[model samples]
Target: MLLAPLALVAACGGGDKGTQEPPSTTAVLVDTLFTFPSQWSSPQLTLKAGGTVVFMFEGGIAHNAIFRLNPGNPPLAGAPADIPPTVNAVVRRTFATVGTFPVNCTIHPGMVSEVVVVP
Candidate 1:
């Protein structure tokens, strides 16, 4: 009985080991609007500036992300920041600007999501 207990403890590697931290960014699953009520997993996501938002799609109906920017919220610097129609793929977008971005999937009307980036 003593040997079995000791073996169990050893197997667990009992020690003050530092725990690993989770990744900074989180993924949002894109679902079919026809079957599901919503498009993105989360309707709205708020994160600090520089944080990344990952959109993951798993086959089936296609989808995309189009950001609606206005004078108050200018377009993202560099290349067009819209995620093209994609399926069974993962797309990542980093929010460096501090503003509210309204995203929608043109493929499916009323399929909308929002992301707010704060300082």
Candidate 2:
């Protein structure tokens, strides 16, 4: 739990407070950029305990998004699987736990960020 908070839904878009959705169904987008601030979605993502995260590779180069135990360390004990590399690719992942989650681009090292999920 290094950072994504899904515990990771998007700041805006989708779901209702109490109508029929728990807000956990909301989706957030993190663009894979090749420059500074690699992840333009947010340095810190705040998501509901059962929210979703959409990793959008909208940058020039190919990129992959993965939820890691320790940034770039691959395959944690309990975490979402890694998103493969591709340009203009879209990955939608849902988190069922309430904790901090870390996301990184497998192809592009040093592109790291965190998401926080609140109860």
Candidate 3:
């Protein structure tokens, strides 16, 4: 009788809960040399908190990157300080806060993209 009740309890989730799965990592390609000189392949990226971003730069021009800071939101750090448009330049960043991080090319005009982090 006790064993039956114990079995029922065990089946009713009466134990320590398992750890929730972490958010999945994401990848964004910054190969605008082929698509358009002033645009990235994916203009908008959405990710969860602690999510990973893999920036793959495929170009032949000299281009750098920067995050356009908004006065009302937290800043996003860890972008590539220098991404010379010499073939394939890769930048990996992890967004810690939940906000919109707008991207722009420092050397090129109108090279804009955005990364949205959500919790």
Candidate 4:
């Protein structure tokens, strides 16, 4: 009867929350040679905590994406043991913690970028 319809409505409305929102995605374009545009030309990125940042290289000269392990710490001259030699091609790195990470190129030295994770 009418009670049955009301019960069904209540059950549907009070049931577990709808599917959680999907994690946001951020893109960093790596251009040819020693440059990655300061900002997005199209489809600007909005990063959040625990988000994924993808470095899409577009005909670059074997560029790399190396992030500083520690922001407060000073930059070291040589490469750290943990960081791989390079991060060429499409590279995806997740930011679980919230902070500003300084990224740079190992081969070109001048090329640099950053991944800022907000909580």
Q: Which regions in candidate 4 have their CA more than 4 angstroms from the true location?
A: 1-46, 69-88
Best by lDDT: 1
Query: lDDT tens string, model 2, 74-96?
Result: 56544577777767666677666
Residue pair clashes in candidate 4: none
lDDT of each: 0.65, 0.62, 0.59, 0.49
Error of 4 at 29 (Å): 16
Q: Which stretches in model 1 have alpha-carbon errors above 4 Å?
A: 1-38, 69-80
TM-scores of all predicted structures: 0.60, 0.59, 0.55, 0.47
Expressed as tens digits, the lDDT of each residue in 13-57 for candidate 4 is: 553567644444442222212235332222223456656665665
User: What would the per-residue lDDT of candidate 3 be over residues 1-119, giving only the tens digit for each residue?
Assistant: 78999998878764445764434554322222222466766788877766656666665655555665432334356432333343456666666667777766756677777777767
lDDT of 4: 0.49
Question: Top model by TM-score, which number?
Answer: 1
Tens digits of per-residue lDDT for model 1, 1-119? 78999898889765556774334464222222221334677678876676677777655668877787432365555213887787777777777777787777777777787887666
Q: Which residue pairs clash within candidate 3?
A: none
Please give the distance, in angstroms, between residue 6's alpha carbon in candidate 3 and its true position after superposition: 43
- Candidate 1's TM-score reads 0.60
Alpha-carbon lDDT of model 2 = 0.62
